[model samples]
Target: MFDQKDLDSIRESRQEWESETLEPFLEKGERKERFATVSNHEVDRLYTPEDVSNIDYDEDLGYPGEPPYTRGPYPTMYRGRTWTMRQFAGFGTAEETNERFHYLINEGQTGLSTAFDMPSLMGIDSDHPMSEGEVGKEGVAVDTLRDMEILFDGIDISKISTSFTINPSAAVIYAMYIALADQQGVPREEVRGTLQNDMLKEFIAQKEWVIPPEPSLDVVTDTVEFAVEETPKFHPISVSGYHIREAGSTAVQEAAFTLADGFAYVEDCLDRGLEIDEFAPLLSFFFNSHNSIFEEVAKFRAARRIYSRVMEEWYGAEADESKRLKFHTQTAGQSLTAQQPLNNIVRVTIQALAAVMGGSQSLHTNSYDEALALPSEEAVRVALRTQQIIADESGAADIVDPMGGSFTIEKLTNEMEAEIMAYIEEIKEMGDGSVRDGVLNGIPQGYFHREIQDASYEYQKRVDSGEEVVVGVNEYTIDEEADPDILKIDPETRNRQLERLKAVKDERDDAAVEEMLEELSEAIDNGENVMPYIIDAVKAYVTMGEIMEVFEDHHGAYQETASLA
Candidate 1:
């Protein structure tokens, strides 16, 4: 970036100024003992050309839409079109959540992101004993195709892109959506959305699973293979770091572990005889944006660069889309506080800005009151307005890679790239050159859990010791007790869901449901792609529980082997 003579001159000048000016000023005023990010990367007082002297402009930070995509994925980025404003909303019965969907869309949201209830996510019906008191508590419940039909009753499927945040039972959800598309007269190729189907992360952090790792992963690969031929526009899998980060990982670990999980899926797909370029382009990612603006930005940038290199070099991907890492960003839920909950709006604003500057394809700004309960209508509208303000009022979106040339940002991106690549290398070595086997081997061994646990413990220790000041949690003490209006699930929500499920069961043809379920069971047993069979069962109104029961009988329930204390 600079000539040797010029660098030498600047180095001498910096030394003289630091000693004569900075040293005296620091001695009088004093400075903090240390400055570091959540990842424990030291922050220098100043950055110069020397900090990024080793970087190659074209090779490392190419123009937008080019290889290694460090600056941004597209040449115009937000200049061409703003990031999609997709809010995650779901609670109570399908009718209720559908109303919220209409509210968000009418409030200027461009996309839909669904959150399933515990019962739906666990692949059980609302009336199941295991689902007692849990139905419609956290997210929306959909037990059969009837619920899905009501969930999108009036919405035109071809017009809006939707994302489903569910795993383990993702294949079931996919079938329901495709069946809905069929009912709506929309061609499968035209329907678009994303499925958060990354199951490896389920074992590592989220702890939501029915079967063990291997078969859970096989079901995921089936969707990927099925999507390539069927739902061409839909993303079959979103390799996620959001849950991993929310479970307490440093930004580096979040990026590394998420990408490794993605690679494992890629390997599994390849082993299934799918071409690299065929399925890779449709694969997407999800990440969390915390309060560390610069660190989070650097993490996103480094991830893009690393993914591009590996896709092309390791997998021999021919298409640029296969190499580019396109991801959706959600503001950190862990950063939200129950006390002084309003402060989360400010936190979300900052995190959302970082995501835009870091080049996210889509963004979800969490409501300030999410720490207490599901967002009220008023709260959710305010959250949507935050994104509108950033896109229209703020000048941050006018340029591509607004922070591309910053010395500190570039330096941090380089360091982040190095650390993330090293972790992937270790995972690969663990499996003796197979990332799929490595992740599979690591899960039962608690390797990933320990890494995340250690980081989480260290961060908690810092907060407890006052080394890290969480504004509402550790510092700025306040004493007040007032109940703010929050969205509450009615005690009758579970009963309503069960009644609806029972009505659907009574109305649908029992013989058709049983025959479809038997066919689905055979598909699973024969090691065949179960997607078509699942779609058939969903269309037959086979309850999610009935379909999942076949799986439990065959695969058995998953029991955690990794011990953590």
Candidate 2:
């Protein structure tokens, strides 16, 4: 924090430099242009001391690892420990993905993030009629506990943490993970990872959902409660803004909406009589690191500041750990272009740098050729090396929050925070009580739809007007044929996976499977915590579809009614 006299002197010097040196150097007939960020917020050409004049250094931008951690959440940050290098991986059967996991680990990846295929994502077994050609297409397919066992066959669960990018059926997946850890002779407390158990974002952005909103929230809260008692190190809900951003929301909307969803989860847990500090610390966040360099950096900084203030002032979270907003960032997959495939390497490197500068706890760099298809072994290595270069070669991480207290960065951080709060108010005004309660009543969905449509329209306008240029997309028109060496899953893998699933089904006791499912259904009907029963069902080799069938019979599927008329 500079003193008043020092601030005045710096401002006077900057004014003289701009008037005498900068202005005269510009072309005489050049007209000033208003630059806007990816979020469509207007950005000024320059920021002076006047922009951050009201900022109290002690209260607003404290030292790293201190309260009001606008600087960073850690004391030494990357200097002490670099951000975790987690490559999001999955393809074909569990065995194939397991080999990929081992390969990445051998390549020096620090964490594991699993991606389930459509069938597994929808809580359907590989043998389901709905899962014909889609098995092992997009991501890996796990039908039962046996698949999970094979997925991490040789990997030590206790030595490495694994993140599951699943929702709607996150509880079931988590139950399988817990059961797997138990089978590995590791205590539940020793197992660590995150479950992207955010159902609200699923309805708002990604439409991969199963149960109705109320029941879904109940199941998610059940996981939260169970995590507090069983696996304290595991994050129950990774409230994700990544999908929302991919769905075309602006950067500010990404921050505010994601945090709003996080608050909704916290409120749900509190309503269930859980203590705020008990479950809030286990709550984590997932956000996007787009191509905007400075804007993305400011977005991450503002997210931490806003979450810290919200937890301390609004929720009265006592523990410092509870107030911390730890987040994982993935480079914008939607931003990748297939035109000039090699250019994507530069794109991902810059995005990965932004995430590191923004103080991410974990990061996943999109492979260069991802826009074409799943990455080849060579492409994934480049992605991993991108992070390694930043961590080792770049001096950006030498100091914690290197951009902290910068005139332009502070100004952008303040502006982004205000924009996010305005969006929150807009959602509240458009709905009944709070936006979360309104979401339960089906009001927030309409608001989200309209907002996304408008944002997309504005983005297209910029592209059409040639105001915003994507290098390979709208600018460089390349007519190259195609790259054929990309990774492709074999058709035989699907056949083998299906055959294995069927063999397991036949070997299991049919009577015990039915009995376990009946007990699971009874637990759901009796309003009992279904985690234990679901774990039991999975252990009995009950297929995912059969388990979901029991729940669907009791709770029914989700039906979204259009209330916009």
Candidate 3:
């Protein structure tokens, strides 16, 4: 940003100021140690033009909506349209979650994010033996197309964008969604939504796999191929780093791991004969907005730059849309505390603010009482209002990339980009020139597991040692009583959901369901795109477990062991 002579002059002036102006304060006791960011990168006390003198602005910090977009994804950004505010809601039953969805939309939410219960995510029906006591406890329970119909009953599929937080059974759920659209008579191209079909992240972070790595990835590829040919506007998979970050990864690891996972999906799609530009634009990412304000903002910027270059150069993607990285951000759930629960509201607000400043396309602000249970309706409203206040009242969204020119942000963004590139290069080398191979190799060997475990351990140690003071966790203690209302799922929600499942089975034609399953098996055996067959089974009201049983039998289950050790 500055000429050589001016940079040299500034550096000289900085040294003089540090000696003459800062030395006296240090001598009088200003503390004698260096500082670092949450990611543990060294931080200078002050940043100036001299700090970013080596940066080439056009090559690194281009205008928004341009090549190697480091500012924002679009030209107008929030000026044209603010980020979509979505609240991740689902619990108890389909009826209950549908009510929450309607409530959120009526309360000014721009999008819907669904959280499926464990059984639904695991491909088990509500009435399954293993699903006892767990049905509809954490999120909405869906077993068949009947549940899918009720889950999105009256909502117009053409207008509202919905995001599903289902992972392992993403394909089955996606088929259910397509069947729902078909039953509603909506055009397939009009069905806009995102599916978290990222099984690689499941292997590396969540460990919720029913099928082993290779086959699980093929299922993901199947969905990508189906979407490319059928649903033009839909995002078949959201490569999520939110769970990875929630699993305790540092900022750099979160970005690197998430991007690597996206790359793996890209490679798999290419193997299926899909061009990079054809399906790449539909790819999306999900990230966690943690407490570190500047670090998170810089990480977002660096992620865009890294992805843009990777697609354009490494993957041979020619289209600008293919090169751009689009993502949804959710405020960090791990930052919330059970003690002095209201403090969580502030934490969420800060994290949400970081996401907005970081130029998120969509955001989900966690409710204050999420640490206690599912968020109360009132608490969810407050969380929605937080995004509204930031958009309309806080003036933060009035300008695009508001911190683009800051010296500290520029330096941090550059440093982060370099570090992420190094990580990607390592992955590429490991995979023999394929990023997918590298992450796949790492998962069985426990590289991601060990790295995240150590990072979490170190962070907990800091909090325990009082070096890192969590507001309500370590430093703040209160004995006074505060009984805030908590959202509780009815214990009978399980029985009601199970009853509904039975009613659907009793009402549907058993012969049709059997026929659909047989056809689906034939399609799978013939290596045909199973989406059409899965849709047929879903429309016939075949249970999720029944469909996944076919896959489980074919691919078998996985047991994680230390291959990388």
**lDDT (10s digit) by residue, model 1, range 410-492:** 99999999999999999999999998899999898888999999999999998899988889789996985874799999999
Q: How big is the positional error of residue 37 in model 1, measured in Å on the Cα after superposition? A: 1.2
Q: Which predicted model would earn the best lDDT? A: 1
- TM-score for candidate 3, please give it: 0.98
lDDT of model 2 at position 178: 94
Task: Give the count of colliding residue pairs in each prediction.
Answer: 0, 0, 1
Model 1 pairs in collision: none
lDDT of 1 at 463: 88
Residue 240 alpha-carbon offset, candidate 1, angstroms: 0.4
Model 2, 218-242: lDDT tens per residue? 9999999999999999999999999
Name the runs in model 3 displaced over 4 angstroms: 480-483, 562-565
lDDT of 2 at 525: 85
Model 1 lDDT on a 0 to 1 scale:
0.93
Overall local distance difference test of candidate 2: 0.87
* Residues 419-501 of candidate 3: C-alpha lDDT, one tens digit per residue: 88888788878899989999889888788898888888888887898767788778878774765798888999999988988
Query: What's each prediction's TM-score?
Result: 0.99, 0.96, 0.98
Q: What lDDT does the true structure give each of the candidates?
A: 0.93, 0.87, 0.88
The pairs that clash in candidate 2 are: none
Q: Which ten residues in a row have the lowest lDDT in candidate 1?
A: 24-33
